[model samples]
Target: MRRPLAEQLPSTLVAALSSAFGVCLLETTGVLAQVLAADSVTGSSATVAALLQVVASVFIVIAVYVGSIVTANTFATIIAGRTRTIALYRLIGSSASDQRRAVAREGLVVGAVGSVIGAVLGTAITIGLVSVSVATGVVPSHPYSYLGPVIALPIVAVVLTTWLASWIGSRRVLQVSPMQATGGAVEKSLDEAAGGRGRSVVAVVFFALGGALLVLGMVIGLVSPLGVLVGVVGGLLSFTGLVLGSPLVMPVALRLTGRMFGRSAPARLAAENAVRYPERSSRTTIGLVIGVTLVTMFAVCVESYQVIITNAQRAQPEVYQGVDRTLTVTVVVFSVLMGFSALIAAVGMVNNLSMSVLQRTRELGLLRALGFTARQVRTMILAESAQLTVAAVLVGLVLGTFYGWAGAQSLLGSITGSPGIVLPAIPLALLAILAVAAAVLTLVASVAPSRRATRIAPVAALAVE
Candidate 1:
């Protein structure tokens, strides 16, 4: 039977939606900037109607990407699990190359469909928002202005990038071997198999490039304020690479530290798990770490902007003289959203860990039978989870600190706007926050799986095969 296009359609539409969101962000931000630059209420109000168009475009794009990723993640995992199905097809005469083509074709369809949908929806939204704004008498419109470049280019680009992103996301699926798909061979350690030795070279190169960019950013600060944005983005990437390379050096450090823990069983086991597969564990936690770190980071960036805006208002207090309260409210709302994103990521990590533990029921049962008590096993797994979350937190703290200081200096220097001098209390507050959240998340993640481990009967566990 031929594969139906509907099975692949959702993901393609999703890719397009994600792209639309990115474009909408750019457009809405531009409109907001324009509003901020305006001197009078009437002038600023004129752009309010246009903002609806930008918002509509943004949501359309977001819907497409979210849809695509959901579809892609689902299918990718399914394909990963359905090696037997593919192998049966091969046994019945489907060639290996044909299998690859089918999977790749599905990916292409997902990307293309998502892209087209996102573009169409985004364009329609932009038009609708503008139309609605005019009808509400918020702003008088003669004809649609700024429609071509902002609306048109984004739609086309989003459609194309959707396909590209989906393809990239699914590329790893095509590399699975037939025997593994057929369950002829058990899966091996992806991290342990991938040696982390040469990461130093990559880190060193990134650090060097980042440092060079920092200097350039300082130079550009005098010419255009955007240089600060450049510096922030570059520094952020460099810091990510450095932290990633931490595991390359982790085993050496952890081995020396583990000697002290050798006297205790739980400690020893925990230490071993922490350092044993640094590459793999680190790779697993990278996405969550980035998400978590962004919490403190977004806060820091907001503080920088708050300072800049505060200073600007101070000099021309009349500009925001009446709207000071309004500005503060908006800033607080943005900060809260950033914090929520981090909490959501923490929950996701916990769910992901629980799912992994559940899937290894047979392996865990055998470990239990081989002299490991339920308590010890639970302790060991929790310890491993703790180690990863703690490392991620520490790394995030370091990155946040760098971002805060660099962003502060950049904004102040580039724009000649400083809100006030920093207090010693801020670092203490941030550090305390990092420690508490890390501990809480670790304990919470371990709780569910720990309970499940104790619930299994040894005979039933052993009989899983």
Candidate 2:
């Protein structure tokens, strides 16, 4: 109960929003399908309805996947913050497994609470919208029950996934030595991170398998569009490997990006601080990476597909006349849906930044005691934020561009009358928008933390446990 609000709000918000998205998406899909099925005018309404359901399922899965990652990251940071307390517990009589299970239970409770609230909100909005649509004659009235057992699925999935994610995140508890109870908060150094060979091996295995699958997907594209499905699996597996190996990967990226700050004292300190704690910096930035990657991947996929469509239309103008409009609308709609996942990630970033600042009170105070000005301290912190954001966005753009190009080629190669390379179409406009949004997010998230860091007296902050 006494845990800081920052520690809990991110996970709760993620759970609630994720469940709400699931419920609303599923219910809305069913309603649309029902309406389409009732439209006796179109002979292919059933097929279209089926497609809608599949797309909705995919969107839901993406949401849950993003939510799970964010939840896990949030819990991992929280566990890091609780190092002192956990070490104390270990020093006395408690075992690591017991402590881990307790954290999982807390996750379960949070998931239940958030899920129920989201489910109720989603149900109400859905019911209200259906009633309005019916009354407005937009669709014919039908016997549709908003309350159904299906709603339970999102609720259950959220609860169970949260539990599982918490367990995964708390794996660090097993490594907390009772001797560390005397020490204050401590984040893993690069050397310590390098020693985790088990994770590195597993990550490499996943990467190898995913890389093989990606190649196979391209080969299969020569024959069928079904290669896109295989590509999706490959992308997921490869991305998982990247996340697992981030402890090793992110530090190098951070060091490279940190150089952009220059050779000033504050700049050097900011650069050093970011690479000083590999785990902390990686956790804080991975969410942004996920967000940017999704947005860019979708943008590249749509633009590349548009390119192919444009060529086809030029060849047969009559058949592809209105297809462009439909494509535009589809991209717009999916982008909005994907935005929710990005929003969840944004919340996680802000939450992690706040917690990082809180955990580093003593470090900041020590710097102050060493005669560092508040402005320099603030600049250092902000610089760290900017450095991480830049690194994450750069990585995301590279990954997303490749994935998007692969998806486009694998899915539409046969449509071009032969299997061939489809050059990726990068949308500069959309990329600019993403970059601007990320910059704003970093600035906004950094402000409060900087203020908090500067406000505390050196002695007072040093006294914090």
Maximum-TM-score candidate: 2
Model 2: per-residue lDDT, tens digit, 1-465?
245565677678767876776676567656665665555542254434544554555545655665566666776777777777777888898898888878788788878888888788767767777787678765568887666566677777887778887777677655868888887666778899889999999888887788778777767766666676677778878888989999888888999999998999998998988888788888888877887787778778878877776776677676445444345434544454456546655776677777777778888999999999889888888889989889998988998888787777777665533326767899998778877887888878887887887799999988766
lDDT of 1 by residue, 334-444 (tens): 354355435434644554455445444555677787888888778776766666666666566666555554544454443333343332113356567767776787677
**Winning model by lDDT:** 2
Cand. 2 Cα-lDDT: 0.74
Model 2 regions lying over 4 Å from their true place:
1-6, 21-57, 89-98, 118-155, 316-325, 416-420
In TM-score terms, candidate 1 sits at 0.63
TM-score (C-alpha) between model 2 and the true structure: 0.85
User: With candidate 1 superimposed using the best TM-score fit, by how many Å does residue 289's alpha carbon deviate from the native?
Assistant: 1.2
